[model samples]
Target: MPEHPWDQAGPRFRPPPGVTLYVPVVVAFLVQVPPTIGVGLWLRAEPRWLLLATALAAASALALLAARAFPGLTVAVVAAIVTADLFLPPEVGPPPIALAFAIVGAIVRGALIWALGSVGAAWLVVVVVGGVNGHPWHPLRIAAATLALALCFAIGAGIRRRVERAASHRAQLVERRRANDQAERARIARELHDVLAHSLSQIAVQSGVGLHLFDREPERAREALASIRRLSATGLDEVRGVLAILRGDDADSTTPTGISLTPQAQLAEIPALVAERTGHGLTVTLDDGLRGRMPRSGIQTAAYRIVQEALTNVVRHSEAAHAVVHLSCEDDVLVIAVDDDGVGSAGRPEGGGVRGMRERAALLGGTVDLTVGPLGGTRVLARLPWEEPA
Candidate 1:
């Protein structure tokens, strides 16, 4: 099965360690203690009430240590502590600083319902009980508290949104890189197949010819051996060029053998390619109608590969005596047609060679068609979109 986008990005976000873990707890406890201590002494509260207030503050602050791990539970627990503290002497009660942290933590961690419900319920109980005790909070104070809690909620929600957006962007980058890697691998595979298949096929044919002529015609056998050597050298150069490109080296660089790494075959080289095939006993002809009009480099490269693969297929599969390759530009489209007088695709299957041909053409917004030719054999016709040289 295909992988999910998140899986590619890696595991889900986690709270950072070390200082972040303890800082909030320390800060909350510190803030909560001052009011509890100062107000309790100012009110001249009994020793037991002041001690209870201090313990309640400590409990609420310590509860926050678990807020990131269990946001909802921490919020509920802290809210209960704050509500109990509210029942103490009004001036001696500490502010709900720890509760604020719990609410924010809960929302940021996606426990919105728990945070909102607990805080709302606790605030309602305080209001109802204060009114019953004839010590109702002032309207402005209640409104300010409500607004502060809302601000905490807003802050948490904003942080959550930002974190989610960042994660989505990271996932997109990972997916794009993966797609590029797959495409590069496919391109390398096609290049390797084209180089190795054509070279091995030619070497096999030449070796067979040399064996057949070794006893009858030693001179012809020597020519076959020479052809094999030339083909091998060219194939090695092309392979090294591909490897150099894969290694992020300059395509125009040279190998240790002093062979210039030719990145791609151009249209001008097709004639030499045809001549090489003709020398291997496969009579091939080239009809160049482009004159001086050259297509863009991309189109030229794709066209050259299409033509090369087609001719390679003909040499390997076609039992013909002669083949013709015609090139022309019609309606701003580069047209390449290779016709052979072979067995007319009797048992030809759409193998990797044909697929590679189509892929090369498609990459240039072009199409390749295989059909019966007027030469009573197979015809590979490719049309690529092109712009004439200015």
Candidate 2:
């Protein structure tokens, strides 16, 4: 469960087992407290009345407490209470509160309890007040039953209204949090694309080019080596820019200073990425026939990540030269495949880093596929959904 800052305790607010559900029963019992003591003065003349009333009140309290174990037992006990009041000479009493408790229990439980409980209570009201014409009919008994029913109906409706409102507010908060989280991830993705992609590309380019210094014009190889030096410095600057953004200090000063690339170049931008390779004597060709750009931001992000990971694999595990990245889209599926002419590099076959990349792809509704290409190069392939702006 997502813990709310305000939930100092747990969500349930459950009362001690019996106390919450049988609160009406407890209150009904307490209602007799005063009368138990006061009636002693009146009942001095007839000790039997005092003894009966006190015992019945105690019995009713016990039955209410035991309601969870024996459902509907309290109804009869309440009726017994009314009977005791009616038969004995009436006096100062706490019996009215007991009547209220019966009404509350009836509404909470079911109709049978209500009918039996009210009838038992009404029998006494009629007998004591004296009916229409010295017979068994009485208006006050009917009025009391009607009033109890209305009170329960009102309380039930209020409880339902509060529950519905709370549910609605909880749903709203969940949706808002989801949206905020998505927006944050997108912002971080963009920063990674700009910094990591450009740096890794430069590193892969000049390092490969500089290695040819022994053969094809040693002077030109020196320039390649110098370019590698500059590229490393630029990569460092971009990484710093990315870190600054993460630390909540993004500004013009935080902008990466380097060979800044376009915002929407995916695997299709392999030509530019391989520009240094082509210049330093390596052949590069890219095929991206799929049109309809896959949202500039998403394209840039996936492109950078795929290329950087592929180049790193080549540098670590390969002996041969050259690389090609084929990117396209078939309807909603974005297809990105990076392959290098390196003979031995089987790619990062198994690692948490690869798992993280897979997770990132899945988050965007896609997956990553790695295999050794027929052209003696490692291939890193990925597919992501093409989602449009709302």
lDDT of 1 by residue, 179-265 (tens): 877777778888887788778888988999999999999999999999899889978987998777777787668876787776567
lDDT of 2: 0.60
lDDT of candidates 1 onward, in order = 0.85, 0.60
Q: List the residue pairs that clash in candidate 2.
A: none
Local accuracy of candidate 2 as per-residue lDDT tens digits, 157-267: 455466567778667767766766665666566456545655665666666767766487788778877887877776676666666656645344533454333333455
Q: Give the number of the best model, judged by TM-score.
A: 1
Clashes of 1: 0
Clashes of 2: 0
Superposing every Cα of model 2 onto the true structure, what RMSD results? 8.4
Error of 1 at 120 (Å): 2.2
Q: What TM-score against the true fold does each predicted structure earn?
A: 0.83, 0.51
